[model samples]
Every structure is written in C-alpha cells, then in structure tokens.
Target: MRAFVAIVPPEPAHADLDAFVAPRRALDSPWRWTPAHLWHVTLAFMAEVPESGIDEMVEEVAVVADSCDPIPLRLKGAGMFPHAGDARVMWTDVRPTDPRGLGDLERLALRTRSACSRIGVPTAGGDYRPHLTLARSRRAVDATSWLDAMEAYSGPAWLAQEVTVFVSRANRSGRPHYEAEARLPLGRR
Candidate 1:
C-alpha cells in the first residue's frame, strides 16, 4: 500500500483557504491546483508499504498520538519549493497560531517520525516544513505573482487532534486520491 502520515486541517480552515483560492483560479497559470478536500500537512511519506505492516503502523502512530495534545495551527502566507525562480511546487505555509504551539508542533512531528522508524517504515528524512501543497508544475515556473497574491492570506485557526494514515490510489486521470485508513487521536481524545 502507498501511504503517508499527515495532519488534516479542520473544516473551517479548509473553507477559508478554498474561498481565498477561488478567485485566484482565474490566473490561468499552467499549474495543476490541488483540490481543497485533499489538503493536508504530511508528516512522513511512506511510499510503498506491505499491507501486512498496516496493523503495526497504526499501533506505532497511536503511541505517538497519545503522547501529544492537540496542536492549534493556521494556514498563513505562501511560498514555493526549491525557491521561486525555479519552483516545482507551490504551497501555503502552516504554523501554530499560539506562540508556544510552534515547539509543540515540532516535537509532534519528530515523535511521529520516530514512531514510523520504529515500525521499520521508510521515512523521508530531512527538515519538516509544515505546509499544505497548493499546486504542482511539470517544469520550473516563475511564481512571483502567485506568491505575492497569497502573501496576505491568513486562514482560520483550527486544532489538529489526529494523525491519519492515508492510502493513496492513482486515478485514471493521473491525479492521486487519498483515503484515510486509520485516524489516531492525539492525547487519545
């Protein structure tokens, strides 16, 4: 199974972002925009794991979830991956609305990654910058204008209380669809 661990924003956050992006869709850029419903902050990307590993993966994630409390996060600002000049992906930055939430989020991410590692799940090792991907480009495109437009966007704050393991399935149109296989509640709430 192709799966990943992520934090799904609440409905209010999604609505706020969707409303903001609706007008910008007229830009007609060659970017393939991601559907708002599929937006998530990915913690660890486990490309392909055997179905037999699902049970162990869920248990590991639950342990990490139970160790942390809900995190308050907001979708704010915009940026591009690999720099703006040669950008491959466009995303909206996600950060804790509360001052202390930043450290909590960082720790949660680390704990989640550790849990995945303990279960022998291959993880994408590197710095984890929390962001919800907005779009992707097949080739490098200048995103200065798009970035500028999104600069003033600040969505509603929502509490992230669960870590979800999502199974990714490829569609006929080449776009990927994600289905939540397991949702482990933080602090067991």
Candidate 2:
C-alpha cells in the first residue's frame, strides 16, 4: 500500500484557503489544483509499504508522536517548486505561529522519516520544507502570476495535535484518494 505521515489542517483553515482560491479557479491554466479534502502537510512520504508492515509503521509513528508536543501552524505565503518561471509544483507555506513551532515540526518530521526508514520503507529524498501542496503542472508553467496572487493569503492557525498515517489509492479518475489509517495523538493529547 502507498502511505505517508502528515498533519491535516482543521476545517476552518481549509475554509480560509478555499475562500481565497474560489475566485481564481475559473482561470484557464495548465495547473491541476489539488482537491481541498486532500490538503495536508506531509511529514514523511513512505511511498509504499506491505500490508504486514502497517502495524509496525503505526507503532513507530505513535512513539514519535507521543514524544512531541502539539504544534501550532498556519498556512501563509506561497512559492513554486524549482522556480516560478518553469514550475511543476505549487504550494502554500506552512509556518509555525509559536516561537518554538518550527523546531518542533522539524523534529517531528525527522523522527517520522527515521521511523519509516527503520521499518524498511523508502522515504522521499530532500530537505523537508513544511508546505501544503496546492497544484501540479504536467509541463512547466509560468506560475509567477499564481504565486503573486497567493502571496496575500494567511489562513487561520490551528493546533496540529496528531500525526495521521494515510493510505493512498487511485480512484477511477486516477486521482489519489487518501484515507486515514491511523491517527496518533501527540504528547499527552
């Protein structure tokens, strides 16, 4: 199964982003916007795992979650992968509102990835930048205008109290559908 660990933003935050993007959706572009229900800050992308490994993955993630405190995060600003001139992916930045939030999130991500590695799941290679992916373009698109439009967005802050392991399956339309397999609460929560 395809799986990943992520922090799903609360409904209010989603609503804030939805309101901001609603007006821009009509614009004709090569970008494929992500569905609102799929918005999440990915901590670790464990591309594939055997069904038997699911329990082990959950246990490892739960241990990491218990060791960390809840993080306060908000969606603000935007940028493109590679660059706006020839960008394939577009995302909104996820920032910690609290002074210690970034550090905490970083630690959480590191631990999550480590756990997946220990369980024999291959992890995504790259420095972890906390962001909620907004769209993807099949070919390089001029995302400068879209980036400019997203600059003014700053959504409501919410506590990320749990790390969820989501199973990804392709729908009939070939779009990925994420289902929460396990939700592990952080710290004492």
Candidate 3:
C-alpha cells in the first residue's frame, strides 16, 4: 500500500479551519479548494510499503514519538510552492505557538523520515516545512490575490499529540484519500 506519516489535527482544530475557509470558498475562486477532511501535515511520504515492513515502521516510529514532546501549532499565513508567480500549490503555514516548540516539530519530521529510510522504505526528499495544503491549480498562474487574502488568516491553536501512518489510495475522482493505519501517540511511551 502507499503510505505516509502525518499529523492529523484534531476535530476542534478542523472545525476552526472550516470556519476560516468557509468565507473564502464562497467567492467562486479558480482553484479547487481542498476539503477539511483531507488536511494533514505530512512528515514522510513513502511511495509504497510492503506488508513485511509495517511492524518495523510502527515500532521505529513509536520510538521517535516517545522522545519528542507534543507540539502546539496553529495554521496561519499562506505561501505558494515553486514560487508565487507560477504557483501550482497553495498552503497555510503550520507554526509552533512559542519558542519552546520551535524545531521540535521539524525534529519529529526528520526523525520519522530517517526511521522509514532505515527500514528500506525510501521517502520523498525535501526540507520539511510544515503546512496544511489548501488548494491546487490545474495550471501555473499568478496566485497573488489568493495569497494576499490568506495573509490575514489564522486559526485557533491546537496541541498535536499524535503521529499517524496513513494508507493513501486514489479515489474515483483521482484525488488522494487517506485512512489511518496506526495512531502513534507522542510522549509517555
């Protein structure tokens, strides 16, 4: 199965994001707005995972989770991927609420990626800049207006206490659908 590790924000946080995005959707924008259910902060994206490795992955990820403290984060600001002028993806920032939480979330991401690679599951290589993807455009275009509108947006804060390994499958519409395979609680292992 296609698998990835991610932080799925809790229900309350989802509600807050819904409230923030409702007004923006009403404007009939050009981008295909992502539904709230699809929101997540990916830690590692492994293209495929054979069944033999699931046990190793869970155990390894659990160890990483044990050492990292729970990170409190909020969704704020906006930016475009591959540059704003020819933007294909737009996302809302995932930021630590205070100085103490800084680097912790990124550490969690890096450790998890390393854990996966140690098990021979080659993960995507990139700098892990935390963000919840908001929407996608079919073609590259100037998304300056959308970026400007999202600049003032900030949602309610929430404690991210768990890391989940998700099985990603393609739906009929060619969009990715996620199902949590394991919920690895952070800390207190």
Q: What lDDT score belongs to each candidate, Candidate 1 first?
A: 0.87, 0.91, 0.87
Q: Tell me, by lDDT, which candidate is best.
A: 2
Query: After TM-score superposition, what is the CA distance of residue 2 in candidate 1 from its true location, in Å?
Result: 1.6
- In model 2, the runs with Cα more than 4 Å from the true position are 169-176
Worst 10 residues of 1 by lDDT: 116-125
Please give the distance, in angstroms, between residue 63's alpha carbon in candidate 1 and its true position after superposition. Answer: 0.6
In candidate 2, position 189 carries an lDDT of 36
Where in model 1 is the C-alpha error above 4 Å?
169-176
TM-score of each: 0.93, 0.94, 0.92
What lDDT does candidate 2 reach at residue 132? 92
**RMSD from true fold, candidate 1:** 2.0
TM-score winner among the candidates? 2
Tens digits of per-residue lDDT for model 3, 1-189: 678899998898889888888898888766888989989999999888887887888888989998888999988889998768899998989988988675999899999999989989888868888888988989998988888988788888889999998887678998877788789889865
Model 1's alpha-carbon lDDT is 0.87
